[model samples]
Target: MFTYERKVTYSEVASDAMADVAQIVRYFQDCSTMQSESLGMGIDFLAQHSHVWMLTAWQIQVMRRPRYFEEIVTGTWAYGFDSIYGYRNFLLKSSRGEILAVANSIWILANTKTGKPERLTGEMVQGYGSEEKYPMVYAPRRIALPKTWEDLEPFEVRRSDLDTNNHVNNARYIDMALEYADPGVNIYQLRVEYKKAARYKDKIWPRIHRENNKLTVALCDKDQKVYVAVEIATDEN
Candidate 1:
């Protein structure tokens, strides 16, 4: 496992004074990069080798929300890899060791020039050192959308939403999903499956399905191609 520490900054807080959901996603991004960098597969290393990794899906469960100004320890480890995907897990813990959240994710490596999935090299797999443990296990590829749902106003992607990939960042998709869920609901779990990349000026229609404490969301384009699908399980409190 690899570990890193970070403090929740004012800019990362939401109106409720808790760290924004997307901020947690950013932490995950940082930890994943840092961990991989240590094992010789950092962004620069991969770019030099003509490959880049893309997140395919996520399953995150929050036990307690981290507040603004809190210093937290974040950790991640790769548990396994297969033909085209690497399975990893992460944790967010308070200074005193309380788990704030835990997540499991799937990632795929692609050839930068071809944009096609590639199998991991033997050396790369050995370097990551599979740990075979998890905080959660989830359906990695699909997030089922309900048959009946309502669509919200379409969102236009701005320059600020794009990342180094020149497309909508994965965290931004989670933020868009959160914006469409019930405000009073405290989300305990959030699962997102990224289907396509959304670039600047792309307009996405957010569709929502709510039943009891469970919510489902899909961000799509004018042609109804889903960019991302989300599943949120909330607690009454």
Candidate 2:
């Protein structure tokens, strides 16, 4: 288990001064990157080897939201890897060691030059300590969509949204979806499934559905091809 400490910055919080869901997503993303970097398989390392990691799915359970200036510890481990995919799990805890959130993610290692998935190397597998275990377990697959959806405002992918991969960073998709979310809802859990990459100049169509305390949002292109699907559960009865 690789762990890192961080103080929730004022800018990381939303209007309530609680760390936003997107901010937690960013922490999870960074923790995984830092974990791999510790093993010498980070972005720069992999890029030098002509490879990049693409997030495919995410499942996060937020027990409690951390507030501004709160010191938190985030840790992640690569549970295992297959021919083309990697499995990871993460945990967020307060300074007192109380668990705040847990997450599961799936990623694929692709070749930059060919854009094809590259097989896992023995070192890469061993370096992450595949045997490290965590209690949270979820299938890393696409979330099923409903037959219909209510369209929300559309958003354009801005230049700042792009990462080193030239696609919108994974966390940015959550931010976009949340922009259309019901402000009254207090999300306790969220699941994000990334279907395709959206880049600069791409316009994303957002749609939302609220069923009691649960909310579902999906992002698609003008052509109706789905990009990211988000399911959220709020703290209401």
Candidate 3:
């Protein structure tokens, strides 16, 4: 029913000079993930029902991503819905409330075995605040397969990538893999698994593959172990 906002901080950026999408994903993910829990229809709730939410798709628009340390307000609330997907809207705004970026996401609560989303329960639906607005996206109109970027000779894991537990941030790996593919500006759906962890000073190689509209991005370590694997699906605007 309401949205939240925050300023853009340096720790959220990929580099000092620009506001990278990776940081944006971090900010958005944190907000959306929490919103899911607040409504009692997210992770914790799904746990009781024997399901996990997967991000099947996303739509993003960058009107004006803020520069480093710029104050911004980030807002998120449940919006629209369809038969199988729930639509969540997120917005980034200036301290004065000017919109900076907008994102629409599609998620499913699936049965782990069948991998199909069951219709959301009445309670779950109401909890998410999906009442009036419902935005529909044509998911069948898929993203074309992107050419794989088979080399990752330049990227390196910095100390900051590690968290308090001394593991690379799960989300950052998804960003690194997608960046190597350079699969155009519009990145929509991403499905990834955190197979293993890579530490600081580790040389990383990104392996990319595409089939139809789905792109597979994987980050491998010096030992050729897969630390991260992501499937990118999109329809370029």
Model 2 C-alpha lDDT per residue in residues 1-237, reported as the tens digit of each score: 889998999889988989988899999888988887777888888988898888888888888899999999998888888899998888999999999998888899889899888998787877887756577656447777777789877878999999988999999889888877788567877889988899999999988877777778899999888899988877523
**Which scores better on lDDT, 2 or 3?**
2
Local error of candidate 2 at residue 151 (angstroms): 1.6
Q: Per-residue CA lDDT of candidate 3, range 1-237, in tens?
A: 445656566566544454666666677778877777666666556767766665655555556657777777676777666666677777777887787666666676666556567877777666777644424343432233344446556477898787543567656676676575553444544445555567788878877776666567767876666776666656443
Encode model 1's per-residue lDDT on 115-170: one tens digit a residue: 89999988788889899667455654788778887978997999999988788999
Model 1, position 134, has a per-residue lDDT of: 77
Q: What is the TM-score of each candidate against the true structure?
A: 0.95, 0.94, 0.62
A best-first ranking of the candidates according to their lDDT comes to 1, 2, 3
Which parts of model 1 have CA positions greater than 4 angstroms off? Answer: 135-137
Error of 2 at 68 (Å): 0.7
TM-score of 1: 0.95
Quick one: how many clashes does candidate 1 have? 0
Candidate lDDT scores, in order, read 0.87, 0.86, 0.64
Positional deviation of residue 132's Cα in model 2 after best superposition, in angstroms: 4.0
